[model samples]
Target: MNQATRNVLCMTGIKKSFSGVPALWGVDFELRPGEIHALVGENGAGKSTLIKIMTGAYRRDSGVIEYDQKSVAFLNPTEAQAAGIVAVYQEIQLVDFRTVAENIFLGREPHRFGIIDRRVMNTRAADILERLGLQIDPRSVVGSLNIAHRQMVAIARAISFGARVLILDEPTSSLTETEVSVLFNVMRRLKSEGTSIVYVSHRFEELYAVCDRVTVLRDGRNIVTRSLSTLNRLELVCYMLGRQPEEVSKGVTAFREQSQNILDRPVLLQAEALKYKKRLDGVSIEMRHGEIVGLAGLLGSGRSETVRALFGAEPLESGTVKLEGSLLSLRDPHDAIAAGIAFLSEDRKADGIIPELSVRENLTLAALPNLTQWGIVSRKQQNELVERFMRRLDIKAASAEQKIHELSGGNQQKVLLARWLCKNTKLLLLDEPTRGIDVGAKREIQQLIAELAEQGLGVVMISSEVEELVEGSQRVIVLRDGQSIAELSGEQKNIKTILHAMAEGADRQEAVGK
Candidate 1:
C-alpha cells in the first residue's frame, strides 16, 4: 500500500505461542485511520492474545507491526502508552483508594513548578468527563462510585492519554443501555478526531450498531475481514464458526415446535406478588411442568429480581412461593435448593462459577451433601455423576481435573448448567443463559435447554433478546417498573407483542395478565 493509503496500524504475519501451543498463527490485521474496527471470535480464537501483543503484554514469536508509518516494538504497556496507544480492559484497573481525578491523571498530572497541581488536574478531569457526557464528579472516590460510573471513569482515563489508537475490550459489559449510548458517542467523537479504535466484544448487536469493519478469527487464524454493513448477522456468525448459513441457522426456534398446553399442565411454581425492596414491587409468576415460561423486561424492571426472589437469593419483604403444592422458602438459597430449585445467575463469573475449582469439583459442588454418606463422600459415586453430566452436556474440557477457569466461556456455562442437572432439581431458573457465547456454543446451549424442558423439567428463563423469549418460552410475562404488567401467549406471543408490553405498557388495550 502507498503511504497515502497505508493503514494507520498494520500487523502482517503475526504469530504467537504459549507453551509451544499456537495462539495466533500468521494473523494479519489492519486498522484504518478514524475507523471503529471490531475484533471478534469465539473464546480461544486468539482475539485476546493479539490485543495483548499489541499492548506489549505478550511478545509475538514472529511478526511485523507498523504504527503510523513506522515499525515499532513496545516491550511494555508503558512504552505503548507513551507511543499514544492505550487499552481499557474489561476489568477496571485503577486505584479504588483514589479520586476520579487522581486516577485519570495518575502519572501525568499537570504540574506548576514540578509540584502536583490539584486544581488544574481536577479541572482537566472534569472537562474530560463532560466531553463523554458523564455526570460523575471528578472528586468522587472511585470506590464509592457504582460499576457503570467506574467503567466510564476507566474510559475517561484512557481518553486522557491523547491516544492516537485506543483499544476497548468488553467496554459495555457493566454498562446500561443509556451508558452504552454515551460510550458510543464518545467513540464516534474520537473517530472523527482521527483516532483508530479496536473494539473486542462478544456482543454481535454492538458490532452491528457502531463498528465500521470486522475481522473474524478462528482456531488461531484469520478467517475473514469485511465491512460489517456488507454481512448480515447469520453470515457473520457463519464466518466465525466456519459453518454454512443453512447448517447453523436451522433449529433457531425449534423449541416452539413442541406443543405446550399450559392450562391443563400442572403448575410447578406459583409465586404470589413477590416484593423485594423497590426492584420488585409485586411480581408474580406461574410456571407449569414440561414448559418454559419467560420473563421479559428492560433493565431494573425486576426480571432478574423475580428469579432471585424465587431462588431465595433475594430476601422478599412479603411473598409466597409454592413448588409442587409445598411452600418454598423465601429467605434461604439452600432451602430453595433442597426443595429442588436450581438457579443460574446472569453474571456467571461473579455468582455462578468457582473459578479455582476443578471441573469435577464445580459440577458436584451443590450436590455434595447428597453425595456424602454419613459425613463421608464416596469418590467413586462422585466421579460417576460428574462423568455422566459432562458427557450429557458435551462440555469441552481437557479432563475432569481441569480447572474451571481454563475452560472457555461456553464450556464454563455448560458446566454450571450441569451443576444443577446433577441434582434432583425440578425447577430451573436460567437468567441470560446464552449471553457472551459464540453462535455455535449458543446454539448448543439453546438446544440443551429445549431438551431439558422436553424431559419434563420446568424452566423459567429471562432473556434480553425478544426473539429468544418469543421462540423459546411457551408464554411471556412482561414486567415494567417492578410489576408484571402483561402476559402474552397464543397468537399474541411474537416479538412485537411482547416488546409492546415491555415498552409501551399495552395501554389497557390487552386483557389483564394471569
Candidate 2:
C-alpha cells in the first residue's frame, strides 16, 4: 500500500497561519481505522487549528490531506460531514426544542413521496440508539435529557452518517465517573465495529482507559506520539507544558512566606462531608482565624464548587458547615451574608460587580442595609464609607461617581473588596481574587490579602496558578474530581507536591492496545 493511503486518514507537513503568524507548522498526523488516537495539548496550542483544518472548518495554507486513499479538499464542515468525517465539539450541537429523533436525522430526514416520514425517522434513530446501548426514547426532547445521553445521541447521529473518522473534543469534561465509564464502553464498542476515533481530553485516567496511542502537541507543533502505557503522568504533563520534570519550580508569585502554627488560632470555619451532585463528593476543610487556606485544582476539579457551597450558592446533598463552632444552616447567599461571611466570586464581571454601577455605588452595595434607614439610603453614610475604603484600598478612579466598567481590572477588584469589608465580614472567600488583573494590580491584591489575614480575617482562596496558591496560603488543599485528596501545610506546600497530588492515583494498570 502507498504511504498516503496506508492509514484511513493522513496529513503531511500541514501548515496554517494567520496574518503571517503560524499556528501550526510541519504538523503530521495520521488516523488508523478502528483505533482510538488521543490528541493532547495545552491551551493556545495548535490542537483547535489542526482540527479545524482537517475537518474543513478552515482552509490550510499548505498541506496534503488524504482520506481513504483519495486526496480531497472540503470547503466546509458540511462537506467534511458528507465525506464521512464528523466532529462533536465540547458544546453539544442540538436544538433544545427538537426531539432526539429529529436532532439525529435533522438535515437528512426520511421522506415519503413529497411528505416527511416521522415513523421511518423514529425507527431509524431508535435502531441506532439501541445498537449503541442507549435506552433513550426517540420522542424525548433533547433538552429533557441529561448531558451523557445527549452525547450518546450525538454519537448515534455521527454513526448514522457512516462516520469513518470521529473526533470527540473533551467528551468527558462534564461527565460523572459512572457516566464516563459508560461513555468508554460505547467508545470501545465503536472501535470494535471498525470506527476510528480521535479522543481529546485532559483526564489522564480516561486516556489510559479508552485510548490506544497518544499525540502531544505544544507551541504550535507536534511534540510526541506514543503509546499511553509508555509514558507516565509527569512525562505527559512535561510534554504538554514544554518543561522537564525537574524544571517545575515555584516562587513565581508575589506572596511572601507567613507564620506557621496558626492552627492554634480559633477555628473560624469548618466544613465536613460536603457533597453537591457530581461536582462535590465528600470535600472537607478547616480554616482558622487570620489564616489563608488555598484551594488548588484543575478545571472542573470542584475548587470553585467547594467555595460556592460554603457561600450557600450550591444546594448540598448532605453536609455540615460550622462557623465559630456554631452549626450554621445556610439556605442561600443571603443566609451566608447574614452569617458575616463574604464572597468575592472568580468571575468579577458576572458575579461580583455590576459593571453599569458607579464605583461608590458598587462599593456600598453590600452594606446597603446598614446605609439604609427607614427605607431610605443615607447618601452621607454611603459616601463616607466609600471614601474611607477608597483611600484604604488605593482604588484609583477618576471619581467615585465613575462607572465601574470604565476602571481597570485591578481597581474594580479593589472596589469589590471594599464592598465586603464594609459589611464586617468575618470569613472572606476569595476565588481567584487577582485573576484577570495586571501584574502590579495582582501584587497589590496579594499584599492586601496578607494584610487582611494579619488583621485576623480567615480567608479561603482558590487560584489556578500553583505558585500563587502554594506561596499565598499558609496551607494548600488539593482537590481532584470533587474530592479533597490532600491537604499540604508547612514543608509540603509547594508546586511539585500539589501537582503530584493532582495527578496521583490516575495511572492504572489498564494498558491500551497491549
Candidate 3:
C-alpha cells in the first residue's frame, strides 16, 4: 500500500497563534497505521501546540486535519476521543483520590436502572490493566499508587476509550528503566494491533528504540521527517538543534570549563547519614564553598527527598547537619534560612511563588524580618532592597508593583533567585530551576548559577535534564532507592558516567533484594 493510503492521521498547513504570536506556522505532520511516530523538538518548538490542535484542546487558526481517511474538525477533547483519538500527557489527568476503576470509567460509568454498576466497571478496568501488563488493583486509590503505576493507569484509560491513535507526551519521564521497558512493550503490542502511536520525548534513546519514524519541529514549524533506520543520533540532534554536532559539544565543554577550578574550595555544608523516614536512608553529602553539586536519579530515586531533608522541609529522623564544620540543628525552614541556607523548590508555581503577589512582595517575602522595623515594614529600606535585586538579577518587570504572575516564566524564576540572594544565602538548593522556561532563559539561569558559584556560594542542583547536570556541576551524587549509591567528580561527571552509575546502582539494589 502507498503511504497516503496507510496514513491514519494527517495534519497539513497547520497554523495556530496566541495573542497575535504564531506558535505553529504551516506545520505538516502525518502518522501511519500501526507505526510509532516520534515528535521531537526542544522546548517551545510548537510540539505541544500542534498536539493540542490535533487533540482538539486548541482550535487551530487554519489547518486541515484528516483522520481515518476523513477530514474532521473536532470541537473538543470529548469529540476527539469519540472519534478514536486520545492523548496521554506527561501529567496524569486522573483524580488521585478516586479508585482506579472509578477513574477509568469516570463520567461514563456502567449503569443499570439509574444506578452505577461498580462491579462491571471494576471488572472492565481490571481487564484493561491486565491487558496492558499492569498488575495494579482496580479498586486501589490512584494517590496510593507509584508514579509508574499512575502512568500505566493513564495509558490503560486511553486504551479503554478504544483509541486508534494514541499520543504520548513524555510518558516515561518519571519512570524507571524497567517501567520504560514495560511501556515500550505495551506500545509495541498496540502498534501490532494496527493502532497509530505518536511518541513525544526529549530522550533520543527512547525514540530510537520504539519509534519507526521521526519528525523534528523547530520554531513552530516542521523541520524534517525521516525513518529512524536512516538517521544516526548526531544527525537527529543536528536537525533538532539546527547546529553542527561539533558546535553543541563545544557549548557543553564551555559550560564544563566554568566548574573545573572549584574542586578544592573549603567545605561549606555537610550532611552526615541523613535519614528521613523511608524516603532517605543514610544519605550523606558534602558541598564546598564555591562548588555546585548535582543530585542525579530517576523520579522516585530520592533526589527531591534528599534536598527536602537537608533543607528541613521534611524532618530528618536521624542526621547531623554541619555548617563550616560546626554541627547545627535545622528544625524547620526558618532555621535553615537563619543558617544562610536557601531552597528553590521544583514546583515553582505551587511552592516557589505567590502568584497574586507583586514582584516586590514575593521577592521580599523571605527577607521581610530584616526589612521590617518593630512590627511594621520600613518602606524606604524595602524599596532599596527590591530595586537592588531587580537591577542585579535583570528581572524584566514593568515595575516592582507588577504582579509576579504577569511576568514570563524566566523572570519569575529570576525573582525567586533574587529572593534567596537578598538574604545573603551561603548555600542555594535549586531543584529543576530551568524547567518550563525557554532556551534563552535557561541559558541565562545556568550562567547565573555559574556566576553565583564563582562568588563563593555553595549550590546543590537537581535537574531532570542530564545535560544541565553534566555541564553545571563539578560533582554529581547518584541516588537510588533512598540511598546514596555513587558520587561522580572531576572527569567522571559526564552524562555517560552518571547514567552508568545509576544503572549500576539499580543492578546492585536488585541483587540485594534478590
Candidate 4:
C-alpha cells in the first residue's frame, strides 16, 4: 500500500436487514492507507452496524467489501482477524478475571512443545505497553484496573494482532485527556506504518483533532464522506444530523412541557456531597419534579459512578440522599427500589437484561413482588403492566413473549426502559439510555424522558451525546475526578457554558492538587 495513493478498504452498496428491519441500506465507504477516517452519526446511525458487517459480526444482505483490492466475505470474527481486520468496540469485551498479558495473547498464545508460553507472552505484552507509553503491570488482572486502563489494554491487544485496518469504536469514551493523547500518538505511529484507521466518536473536537477524513451517516444511510479539511465542526454536525447548521437550532424549542403537576412538587431525589471509592470525589446533585438533571464530563470524570452511588450499586463512603425532605435508605438496589428510586445501568447486556428471558419476563423481573399477592404472582397484573410500558416505550417485538436476545439493540434498550417503568418510580437514574439504539429509537427514548419529567417523575440522565444532554437537561451538573465542580441551570444552562465549566474545573482541581 502506498501512503500517497492506495485504497486499503472499500465497501459499496452494503445492505443488511434483521427481522424485516434494515440496519444498513446502500451504504458506501472507503478507508485510505495511512489515513485516519472518522465515522460520525447520532445513536443508531448504522455506525456500529456497518462496522460489524465489515468485521464479520453480521453478514451483509447485499454488498461488496474489498480489502486490498480483493473482495472477501468474512464468515466470523476469527476470519476477519485472519484478514487483518481488528476492532476495539465501545462496550468492553475483555474477560475481567484474566491478566493483561493473558488477554492480549488469548486464543493465540505462543507455545513451546504444545505447552502455553507465559513468559514470552508477558515479554511481548510488556513491549507493546511500553510502545504505547502505558505504565502498568502486564501480569495485573484486568478486573483490578480502572475503565481507562482496560480500554488501553483492548487497544494494545488489537495492535499486537498485527491489524492493518484498525476500527476503534468510541475508543476515548472513558479516557482522560492525557490517556486520549497517548492513544492519538499510538494511532499516528500506526499510520506511519501504513495502517488504515477508522475512528468513530461523538466528540467533534476529537474528530477534528485526529481524523483526516470524515463520513457521516443518518438513518442507516451514508450522508457524506469528505476530507476533514473541507468541513468545520458545525458543518459536520449538520451533515450527521441530516439538517442544516441553522436548522439544528429550530429543534431546541420543541422541548416544551408535555405533562402537568410537575413544577410545584418538592425535590423527589437529592444527593449531597456524595463520595464513592476512587471513582467519585465529593459530588452533589439534585432532581426535582418536571425536570431532568444531566451529568456531563469526559470519560473517567466519575459521571457514571455518581449515578451508581445514588442507586447503591456503588457504596457511598460519605454522602446523604433525601427524598421529599426525608433521608432515604439505600443500602442496596432492593432498598433503593423500595424507596421509589430506579436505576438503568450502563451495561445493558451484563447488568440490565437477561438473555434467556422473555421480554415481558425481563420487564417485570424487578417489580415482581408488587405484581404478586401473598407470594403468588398475579399473571393478569404482570401482563397489564408489561403491555402498558411496551406501548409507552414503543418497544417493537414479535410479541411480549419474544426472547430479549432476538430483538434489535434498540428494542432491547426499550425493554430495559420498561423494566424500570414497570416499577412505580418517583426518581429514575438513566445511564446512557439511548446507547446502541437506532436514531428513531434514540429520539423516542429522549422524548419519553422529557415526558416522564413532565409527569413529575424526577430524572437523572447520563449520556455521551452532549447535544442531548444540553437539550434535555433542566440542570446540568459537571463532574471531574469524582467531584462536582459546577452546576448550570435555569438561564445559565447551555452546551458551551457547561463545557467551559468542566474544563475550568478540571484545570483548577489539577492546580490545587499541585
Candidate 5:
C-alpha cells in the first residue's frame, strides 16, 4: 500500500523472443517489499516468459533487472535461488519417488561430516510444513500425496531457500477451496514477514481476494498496473483480455425450441455415485445424445475430476459408468477410447499433444490401431484420414507433417479435435478445451462443439470461460467438491443459471434433504 517504498524487485525493458517470435516486448514489472503482486493476462501474454527470464530459466534478449537496488544476472536456476529468488510453478516439477523431506531440501540437503542427515532434513521439513499450516509426514513419498499437498511441498521448498521474492504461478488451479484458503493464509503470513510475492493466476476472483496490486499484459505487452482497490473483476478481465468488457462481442445465448428435444433422447452416458479419492466424492451425472453438457464449477470444484473419471483417466473407486445401456468398466484411457469416448485434457502442453510428433501423427495417435494393416501402419490411409479431418475442421497447418509444437495453440487444439473425430468417437470429454487459445479459434471451437452435438455426438465440456460454457452446452452439470450439485436443463440453461448452480450447491442438497 506504500507507493513511496522502494521496490524489492524491478525489471525494465525486459524483452524475450522464442524462435524469432517476440514473446515479451519491453515489459516493465515491479514487486514491492511485502505485497502480493499479480501478473494476469490471457494465454501467450508473456507472463510465463517474464517469470522464466526472472527465474533464469530463459535469458532475456534485452533487459535490466534490479533486485534490492543492485543489478544482477542469473546464469541458472541455482544462481537465482542463491540470490533469494524462487518460483513455484503451476505444473509442479518434483521427483515422485522422493520423500516430502527429500523434495523440500532437494539439491541443498543437510550433511554432517560427509554423511546425509535424514533426521535433520525431516525435522526441518516438519518445521517448514508447520509454518505453512500444512500437516503431512515428511517421510511420505511425494507421489502418494494429493495435488494440493504436492503444491504445498513446492511452496515449502521455495520458502526453504529463504527467498526474499517468491513467484507462485497458478498455485490454486488444482487445489480445493479449503486448500486455497490455506495457501492464502500462507501468503498473508509471508507478506507480513516482508517477503514480496508474485502471484499468477487466471481465476480473477482470487486476485481480489489475495493480491495487493495487479499488472495486466496483453499480446506480449504490458497494458496497465493497478492496485486491487482501483479495479473491479470485470475491469481487470477487460484489461487482461485487451478489450472493453462491453465491447467484446457475446455469442448467441437464446435457446431454440429444438434444444428441449435433446433431453428426450437416449441417455448416452450415466454415472451413479461416482467416487474417486480426494478428487471426486460421490459425483453422479448423466448425458444424452445430441446434447452438449457443461460441467460448471469453480476452481477445484471437481469439474475436471468428474470429466477425468468419465474419460477413464482417473479410476473411480466406487461407481458404475453405463454407456448406451451397457455397463462399462474402463480402467485406462485406451479402454475409454475403445468404448468410443475421447478426452481432451485441460493442460494441452502436458497431456494433449506429442510435441515431437507431427500434427498428423498426433491426430491419428488414438486411431492408429484401426489404421494399421497386419501390424503395419498404412501411411496413405493415415494421410487420407488426416487430410479429411484437417479440411473439415479448418485446421490451419503448413502440412500434416508439421510438428504439433510448431503450430499455434488454436491449430494444435483443432488437431486434438481431429484426433477424437478420426476415432469415430460418440462421446467427447472436453476439459477447458478453449483455454489459452485465441478469440477467433475459441469461437470456431464453440461452433464445432455445437455442430458435433447436432450430428448426435454426446459432449461433456468443462471451461472456466463462463460464456463459452453457457453458449456451448445445452445442459449444465454443476459440481461442488467433486459432487454433482445441480443440473440446469431445458429453458434454465444460461450463464446466470449455471453460475447459480455452481455457486449454490445447496439447491441439490435441499431437494435431497427434503
Candidate 6:
C-alpha cells in the first residue's frame, strides 16, 4: 500500500476542553486501513474524549481530521455515521423489547407505500448477520439474546451503516471465554475485509491477541504509538502509568513493609461456603474489625456476586453467615442492614443515588426509621446527622436541600456513604468505589476509606483497578470463574503476585475443563 492510500483516518493536533478543563491537549492519532488499532489509557486519560471527538459525539476545540484523503469535520454523530465512522460501546444501545431486525434498521427502515417493510428489514438484517458470521435469529427479540449476541447485533447495526472505521469499546468485558473467541473471529473477518478498527479495552491479553498496533495516552496527551510486535507488555504498562518498572516494584515493597497492625482484631463478619446458583461457588470470606479486605477479579469472576450474597441482595443457595461469632440469618437486604451491613453497588447512578432527592434525603435514606418516631420523621435529628456527615465526608453542596443530581460524582458518592454511615453499620461493602471520577475525587475517596478502616469499620472493597486494590487493602482475595482462588497478604499483596494468582487460576480452570 502506498503512503497516502494506506492511511484511512488521520487526526492531528486535536484539542478539546470541558468547562475550561482540557481533556485532550493537542493529541494526534491515526488509523491505517484494514488494521486494528488499540486505544488504551487509565480511566481519566482522555481516551473517551478523543473517541467522542473522532465519532463526532463532541466538537473538537481545534484539530485537523483527514478521512479517505479528504479533510472533514462532522458536527454530530449522525454526520459521522454518514461519513462511515461508527462506534459500538460497552453498554449495548438497542431496543430490548423489539426484534433484532427492527433494532438494526431502526429510524431508517425500508418502507413501501408509506408503510414500514418488515420483510425487507428482516432480510437485510439476516444478510448482515450472516456476513459477520453471526448465527442470530433476526426476528428474535433483542432482550432474549445473551450479552454476547446483543453485542453482535450492535456490530451488525454499525456495519449496516457502512462503517469504515469501527470503534469497539470494552466489548468483551462481560463475555465468556467462548464468546470472546467468537468476537475475535468476527474482528479478524472485519480486518481481512479492509475495515479499520479502533479497539479499546483494559484487557491486555485481548489487545495483544487482536490488535496490530496500539496508541497509548496518558494525562490527555499522546504518549506513544507502536506496533504490537515491537512493544512488550511491561513497556506498554509503564507508558500508560508514567512509571518505571523499578519504581513500581519499590512502591509495592513499601506497601508491604508498612503493614497495619490489625491481626489481633476479632472477626467482624464471616461468610462460609456462600453459594448462589452459577454466580458463586463455595465462596467463603472473613473480615476483621478495623481491616480492609480487597476483592480482585476480572468481569464474571464472582467478585460482585460474593458481595451481593453476603449483603443478602441475592438469595444464597447454601452457606451460613456469622457476625461476632453468632449465626446471622439474612432473608433480604433489610435483614442485612438490621445486622449492620451496608452495600454500595458498583453502578452508582442506578443503585446508589436518587437523583431527584435532596442531599439530606439521600444521606438519611437508610437511617430513615431511626430518624423517625410515632410514624413521623424528626426533621431536627435528620438535619443534624446530614450536616455532620456532609461536613465530615467533605460533601460539596450549596445546602442540604440541594438536589443530589446537582453535585459532582464524588459528592454524590459521599452522600451515599453518609446514608450508610448514619445507620452505624459495622461492615461496609464497596464495589468500584472510585470509578468514573476524577483524580482528585479518587484520592479523597481513598483517604476516606482509610479513615473508615481506622475507626474500626470492617471494609470489603472490590475494585477493577489493580493499583488501588494493592494500595488500599492489607489483604486481597483473588477470584476466578465463580471461585476464590488465592488470598494474598503482606508480601504477597502486590500487583505482580495478584495478577499471577489470577492467571494461574484461569490456567488451572482451563486444564480441568480440558
Give the whole-model CA lDDT for all candidates, comma-separated.
Answer: 0.84, 0.87, 0.85, 0.81, 0.83, 0.86
Question: How do the residues 1-514 of candidate 6 rate in per-residue lDDT, one tens digit apiece?
Answer: 6645778999999999999989999999999999999999865689999999989999999989999999989999999999999999988999999999999988999999999999999999999999999999999999999999999999999999999999999898778889999999999999999999999986777878999999999879999999988987657766775655245543331123223778788889889898886678888899899888999875566899888888889999999999888898888998999998999999888999999999999999998998889999999999999889999999999999999999999889888998999987999999999887777788788889888888899999998667778888888998876788888887667776665555456444334233
Q: Which stretches of candidate 5 lie over 4 Å from their true place?
A: 1-4, 38-47, 88-162, 169-189, 200-211, 215-258, 272-283, 296-304, 345-365, 371-373, 376-419, 422-424, 431-448, 463-467, 478-492, 495-514
* TM-scores for all predictions: 0.63, 0.81, 0.69, 0.66, 0.72, 0.75
RMSD from true fold, candidate 5: 5.9
- What would the per-residue lDDT of candidate 2 be over residues 131-202, giving only the tens digit for each residue? 888889999999999999999888888889989899999888778788988889889988999899998887
Error of 3 at 183 (Å): 4.2
Q: Comparing 1 and 3 by lDDT, which wins?
A: 3
Per-residue CA lDDT of model 4 for 388-437, tens digit only, reads: 98887888999999999999888898788778777778888898888777
Error of 4 at 509 (Å): 20
Candidate 3, residues 13-116, lDDT tens digits: the string is: 99998999899989999999999999988656899999898899999999899998889999999999988999999888989999999988889999989899
Residue 63, candidate 3: alpha-carbon lDDT: 81
Clashing pairs in model 5? none
Residue pairs clashing, model 4: 281-482
Compose the digit string of candidate 1's lDDT tens values, residues 147-196: 77898888889889888889999888667678788889888888998989
lDDT of candidate 5 over 1-514, digit per residue (tens): 4423589898999988889989999999999899899998765688889998899998989989988888888988899998999999889999999999999999899999999899999999999999877888999999999998899899899999998999999888678888889889989988998999999976656878999999988879999999989886546645654444244334543222236587578999888999887568888878899888888776567888888888888888998999998998889887888899999998899998999999999999988998998899999999999989999999998899999999999899999999999887989999888888887887788778878888899988887666666567777787776778787665566554554455445453344323
Which prediction has more favorable TM-score, 1 or 4?
A: 4
Clashes of each: 0, 0, 0, 1, 0, 0
List where candidate 2 sits over 4 angstroms from the true fold: 1-35, 39-80, 83-103, 130-150, 173-179, 192-194, 200-202, 213-227, 238-245, 248-251, 506-514
The 10-residue segment of model 4 with minimum total lDDT is 245-254
As for lDDT, the candidate ahead, 2 or 3, is 2
